[model samples]
Target: MTSAYPNGDSARDSQDVSQPKQSLFPDAIAIPPEVLARHRALVLDPATAARTKRGNRPISTVYRADSMLIPLREVQSLVPRPGQVSRSEINNELAKIGLQLRPRPEQEVIDGAPPELGVSVPLVRLEDAPADRAPDPWTALVALRDAFGDRVKHFGLDHLVLSASVAVEGAPVSHGGMVGGTPVSHGGSVGGGTVALHTGSRNPVALLMPQPPRPAKVPAGRRPVVAVLDTGIGPHPWWSKHRPGDPIIEVSQEFQDLLAAQEGQQQNPTELGPLNHPEDVPNEIQPLLGLIDSHAGHGTFVAGLVHQMCPAAKILSLRVLHTDGFSTEGSLLLALHWLAKRVESGDPDEMVDIVSLSLGFYPETTDPEKVLQVKAAIERLTSLGVLVVAAAGNDATTRPFMPAAFGHGTGSAASGVELLSGVGARNAPGHTTAAFSNWGEWISRWAPGDALVSTVPVWDGAALGGIRYPDGGGLGPWMRSAPDPDDLRSGFAVWAGTSFATPVVSGLLAQALAEDTTAKTDMVGRAKRALIATDAELARRYWQ
Candidate 1:
């Protein structure tokens, strides 16, 4: 077994130190009282609590695994320290169960103060037994707790985190049947009398559209850069034309692996013969435009919004979320670390003016250590003058969402973070908040996210999953289709969620930073001030 202590000290040896006594569950920790009460209740009746929690949620959404972060001291007290417990031993002890343990990296110290817990053990799910054996998750958790008692510091679902956006809505409206030998859709109007071509098709065999002109240029070195941490960017024409050079600076290998795994799972044996090559098919007909999954194009859409709002701002695409739009807390933390590294690199161009995070997680417990880690990461980034923006979530509940809710406190770093809530489009204004958007005082800003039209991976034939179109029937319109004329830019789609709202705020902030010369060095403070001004202005215009 590997030593739990960084100094190579065994768990027992580390416990014999003459230092001051420390409680595994410390008073300074910030686990919400309600969370603790619920945990206690759960431990008392695992089966009932588990069943109740899983009753309404679809099985697809419910995570079958429970991940626990155990402190080293607590582990030392266990009958068999987690590090000392082998896979076979655990499986044998708890029938039809599996456990895998890995040591967590040391927690970051804040303000020159060391963290309460020096080392943590991450207990992850390896696999599950047959359903007839017993209900999973709860059964597995109960068995581990029975064996380890209080040694299990914090237990929660290894939630499958995803973008806070809801499904796409409304059918795209097309203009005259053809314009200059091309099928074009009239997208209302942009500046003055100019009609926006929402959708355009060239040859009947080749559904090509004309690309929009390049955005107006800004003064060199004056453009604010926004880093998008989401799914990977694209091979779309718009992105390809705008970002001629290397656009995506970083792509997470873990996310790529997950994407490949999803693609492998999505492979249809009937559609493609046993030996058919995927590359032979046209790009437009492929699902997700041959990307990993439906949500793989999410980052591109978000970047498009930012570009549309702040044409002068540069974009840095950092792929963190998997193709399915899911990522774990550890993955997020690593991404933040990467961001911090880039900012500290001393290259002015690499320094991100703002970070747009459209993703979040809802942990069953508010484990103080985990919360503090996230807070520390945010503080580290903000302290370096990078503004962070996040979605308020689509849960449609008052339950607080992290990173977003972290933006709300009195802490110095909190001011640098902004939380965006979702609102209906200006044309379809009725409800102050979108029905699916999470709301409360924690949300710092609101932006139009309902029925938002943005870029999507180009595809033809039918949208993935053969989802129904808003026109009351038939297959959904593809953002990109086969025989696509290379003359036009990529496709677009109408989606809704607080996820999109976050990027709106991010783009607005980037625009503010680009236009204000004096605010460049202190963009965080500038962004907060701008947010306050906008809030007041919005209230005066709408609330009045």
Candidate 2:
């Protein structure tokens, strides 16, 4: 069991004296020349360059991080504990070594301190900093590292990044971890009651995923299902028709099959499901949709969005979060693997056109651990022609969030959290990055996260099975009157964070697949580009 961990820190007793300092943190991966070229081009656009006033050279963008890169913030201190001088202080001391915090548009003031001492501020890049220079950022970081010593126990890529381990505080920050507020989607209190600013409750999708107009005939006859894998779903009015026999309804019996194969399979190949189409429709409500985890109503809420956007589309729900709000290990991988099988059936007519995951974590987790799990799942599904959309995370770090960011790997590090494709948030009217959403290396696009709206389940804890009220199980579940569509009401709320961003993208993608199943080629890249292009278009307004 200990060996299951990729870093192998669980069995620290069986020692190898040789490998100590070499790989203390994740090593920086070298970027290929081609990708770097594209990244440079994007950051140095003429209009973008116009934003810079610092280096004399016009530079627009600050940092270009990996899709899964999570930025680590260093602790700021002038007088290093008994042993060292702060890097900011050190920079101020050296007339030649002026500390440049933010550069491009404006240079930060050093406060006339010493060169040996340093202040840990927000990590800066060329676009957002005072000066862009080779080797200096690394140099400033090293000065901090030398002063901090083993207190830098945080783990991540080093040389390229200022190793997350060495900071004074030892906790690894959650890139998309800080999100959620209030409860609109489920049986509260019982299922790990949600709270604002603490990464809790009723989280979901992105907004306005641009799609080409489709013909009206397809949706007129048949509707497809958009699967959302999140914490759990509440028993809202949307799922009033849910039944007992089909407690765990899915598109087919292939759910278990997908889970089993993923446990040990390494390299992902084709994962399409077996044919199980019965020409005659069953009498019961087709178990076209499913809800998992007695406690996690998140799955319920995420799937509900699909229902709202594409009224005709069916839903295949998978519960990955436990009744206690904890999403178990291996569950996410199973969900992705399951989704791949359903999409790669060869017969395009029966495939699930869109798959949605509204979870986020650091990018490294996306590699051999989760990335292979998802990418393999995606390659197979998309090849068979399915679209997968995820949240950009609500951590709102300076860099882009994970899963959705390009080239990120997957693997759970210290916390048992699995990072998935993430969604960035946006504000109303402005649609800029929502204040609550987390950011990472690849900050591609942004949509609404703060004060967004969505649907949740309406059921007593016991009726929903084992779940209870948010205040903890002293009383029986609260039964509010079901939402009546005819009676107008306010469904939108002022919640914020990363989980909020994913559903919008998922809903939009589902709309596209439900409307035009034929446009599945290169859909993943196209969707990514569309998101960025849309944000870029919105950005034009600010510049003008």
**Whole-model lDDT for model 1 versus the true structure?**
0.48
Best model per TM-score = 1
What's model 2's lDDT at 233? 44
Q: In model 2, where do residues sit more than 4 Å from their true spots?
A: 1-221, 232-234, 240-295, 348-350, 363-373, 398-401, 407-422, 428-430, 461-495, 517-544
For every model shown, what is its TM-score relative to the native structure?
0.57, 0.43
Model 2 agreement with the true structure over 321-407: per-residue lDDT tens digits: 333222222345446555655455445444565666565334332333333323444455555445556565543243333345532
Q: Lowest-scoring 10 consecutive residues by lDDT in candidate 1? A: 272-281
Q: What 10-residue stretch in candidate 2 is worst by lDDT?
A: 161-170
Q: How many clashes would you count in candidate 2? A: 98
